[model samples]
Target: MGFDTFGDFPTTALEADQARRDAFVADAGGESIGVDQLHRVLAAKGIAGNVDLVAGDICETVPAWAAANPDVGIVLLHVDVDLYEPSLVVLEHLWPRLVPGGVLVLDDYGRWEGETRAFHEHFGDDPPPVERLPFVDATPVHVFKR
Candidate 1:
């Protein structure tokens, strides 16, 4: 699942790997897909491909998403603390809703300065131990669980 406020996407100008760069630019002239459209695409692709997209303020949209998905046992929270305030606010509310064993992967927590600061300030020294997730050609990402 993916969530965003602007919902910008690559315009459709299908090409090969290197040639496709232009297809995914600020104004690639590609078409955009909405949540309903994504549902249709995924439904045709496979019945088990259950994905959802929400476009709104993180604070408002995340809670609504949680309510809509009461059966979601584990949420691999991929946080991108674009800034500090709102991200922490969402985490504050979202943390209590997570199941005991569910994981919360901080995507940008250790990489970005502001994000790391927000997380540290919120949890102090009580944040989960950092572990490196498997990586292929790139550097391994640091994952902090709930």
Candidate 2:
């Protein structure tokens, strides 16, 4: 849910976004999509998911969200390390919540210098082995086990 704007949370902008999406849907002339329909479509494609797009800084948002979601298992964490410093803090907050054998996928791992540095620093020596997935060769995504 990396919705628009640079560095700022999109709390103010999301209303407009919702309106835009609604307008787009209206123009498309299709039945409205609800959570169940979304889940059905995702499941048909072999995916099961839920989304909670929190609007706040990583330090403040992640820990609270984790506490609220204690029973959640097998997290497929998607990290957006646009700013490595803050992303590192977010990773720290998320690591413990991740169950054993869960996967953490870091987007832009090999491409962004700040992301690479931040990952190394946060994981340190004896960090979990990172597997670079085959995507765009220039900007490979990396996966690590929890």
Q: What's the TM-score of each model vs. the native?
A: 0.60, 0.60
Which structure among the candidates has the greatest TM-score? 1
Collision count of model 1: 2
Off by over 4 Å in 2: 1-49, 68-71
Against the reference, the lDDT scores of all candidates come to 0.59, 0.61
Estimate, for each residue in 45-130, the C-alpha lDDT of model 2 and write its tens digit.
Answer: 77545433454566556667667767765467778634555556667767666788889888857655555667888888868878
lDDT of 1 by residue, 1-146 (tens): 66655344322222232243343443564344566776777788895266666775665777777688767655576675344554566577566666766667676565544455667877786877677776735645666666
* Cand. 1 Cα-lDDT: 0.59
State the lDDT at 131 in candidate 1: 78
